[model samples]
Target: MWADPNVRAVLVLLAFAAAYVLYALIWPFTHCGACGGGKRTAPQSQGRYWRKCGRCGGTGKKIRLLARMFGRNP
Candidate 1:
């Protein structure tokens, strides 16, 4: 089975798909609570910039969207 090129390709594809699905399930995309998902306007203080998001720490990912849809916290 492993010797077949098609089988190998399919296995690899499946592996990748599974990994992506797992990752998405665990960490679905979410808007950052801080900065209001980057929509908040920053105040210029002597050319100073805004700090990192306090909720997602500037990662822009707060809670998982999937979890929120399911009424669960991620």
Candidate 2:
């Protein structure tokens, strides 16, 4: 019974869902992976000015998708 491919797929999917839910509860916010949690962009060769991060809007934080579903807004 446990060897069934269809059953195994469903179980794997359920496990992933459960893990994501737990992750959402434990960590509703995550760092800006795009910017490595930095508020500004690296200095470019074209100029020597720093700009705000595009991914995190210079805040260095991002709300998780499930957290938004749970009513935790940015």
Candidate 3:
């Protein structure tokens, strides 16, 4: 049974599938900036969760934080 062509094909497909699964689990992010620069911006707070802001390139407005801390309107 192991020598059968169909079984070999199935095994090869399963091996590839397993490898892909492992790769995906280890690196879930597709556009992760782990490469050069690696300078990521702050995320915006949404109730409790903070999502990456596209407008500011993921960097939340720092000035806004300072203004709020100083009791000024942002």
Candidate 4:
């Protein structure tokens, strides 16, 4: 029941676990560091425009922390 302390503790634990799992799964597709996630434009004064992201290789996806830690290439 809602009044049970054990139930409340379990619910909190479950919520934290779920959050962690979600973060791990979706952390890879965050954004491109070079392109600023495709939101900003490159400087025109430098005579360069629409260049591909160097870090993410223009795919706009980053390597997940969990994947790198597990020795898997992203």
Candidate 5:
């Protein structure tokens, strides 16, 4: 079974999926990519005015996509 290429691929993918789910459950929040968790971003040009991050909406944290899909919202 382990010698088969298809089997190895499937096992690797399954492990990855399991790790992703575990991560989603453990740490459901990730840094705001848009503002780098600073909670502020310039909405207009280069540093014109610091405002709330559009992605995380100023909370500085964004719920993981997997968490949202699993009905986790906080």
Candidate 6:
């Protein structure tokens, strides 16, 4: 299976995307809480401000893009 052209292409893409997200998540300056520069008075951003919440990790953005790409939601 690994020798297949399609399989190799997909594995390469998945590996690259995973590496990017891992780098983004591990970087110290990536989280908002570490930088400390945003106002958390808004209702939507209340719990997500400054990397306070574990769900969004201060970015206030969902990681649903990959889920959608794979035709699944959770």
Best-matching candidate per lDDT = 5
What tens-digit string does per-residue lDDT give for candidate 1 at 3-73?
A: 99999999999999778667767766767766666554465555334677667776666766545665556
Worst 10 residues of 5 by lDDT: 40-49
TM-score of each candidate? 0.46, 0.66, 0.42, 0.45, 0.76, 0.37
Model 4 clashes, total count: 0
Predicted structure 1: lDDT: 0.68
- Across 17-66, the per-residue lDDT of candidate 4 in tens digits comes to 77876777656456766676654445773644466666776666676676
TM-score of model 2 vs. true structure: 0.66
lDDT of 2: 0.80
Which RMSD values do the candidates have, in order? 6.2, 3.9, 16.6, 4.5, 3.8, 10.2
Q: Model 5 off-target regions past 4 Å?
A: 39-49
Ranking by lDDT: 5, 2, 4, 1, 6, 3
Candidate 2 regions exceeding 4 Å error are 39-51, 54-57
Q: Give the Cα error of residue 18 in candidate 2, in Å.
A: 1.0
> What lDDT tens digits, residue by residue, belong to model 6 across residues 1-74?
88899999999999998986665454423223433434344577655543344544545344344444554443
Q: Give the alpha-carbon lDDT of every model.
A: 0.68, 0.80, 0.49, 0.68, 0.83, 0.53
Q: Model 4: residues >4 Å from true position, as ranges?
A: 1-18, 40-49, 71-74
Question: How does model 5 score by TM-score?
Answer: 0.76
Instruction: Report the C-alpha lDDT of model 2 over 15-54, residue by residue, as the tens digit.
Output: 9999998898788898888777763445563533276777
Higher-ranked by TM-score: 1 or 2:
2
